[model samples]
Target: MPVLTAECDPRNIASIALLKKLRFEQTGYAEKNFDYGGIEMCDTAYFELKRKT
Candidate 1:
């Protein structure tokens, strides 16, 4: 089996809702460094979908 993984900013409620609607499950949470305008620590929500066998 394989898994599809993704991460999104925790503050984005719309994205989170969309992911949930698509049947992806929240796997974990973490703080990740991102370089949007400059390097900064951002809280992330991890999601994953496991392939049905």
Candidate 2:
């Protein structure tokens, strides 16, 4: 079996677009996703590649 994933700052439009072009399906999201610097927070989006048969 083969699989792939896309995880990155949700603010990155280019990256998100590229992932979609690569056939990854958006699956999840989170707000204030993590503590980047103990002061600043970040948002994130997750995508998974479609399984091939």
Candidate 3:
């Protein structure tokens, strides 16, 4: 089967570690803003991942 990849928050240390353990690589990044309750927050960092063969 072909390998699949996904993107997630790098702020989540556990998830980043798991992806590294699985051989995922940082390919690109993007900016995103989200609203929680009544507050808006923005993130500026590389948040992309890819499978490494």
- lDDT tens per residue, model 2, 4-52: 8779899999999999989898999999977888988999999999688
RMSD of each: 1.7, 1.5, 3.9
lDDT (Cα, tens digit) per residue for candidate 1, span 1-53: 89999899999999999999989999999876555565677888999988899
Best candidate per lDDT, number?
2
Q: How far is candidate 1 from the true structure (C-alpha RMSD, Å)?
A: 1.7
Residue 37 lDDT (model 3): 52
Give the backbone clash total of model 1: 0
Candidate 3 C-alpha lDDT tens digits along 1-53: 35556566547678777777877666655565543355645443343344345
Q: TM-score winner between 1 and 2, please give it.
A: 2
Q: TM-scores of the models, in the given order?
A: 0.80, 0.82, 0.54
Residue pairs clashing, model 2: none
Global fold similarity of model 1 (TM-score): 0.80
TM-score winner, 1 or 3: 1
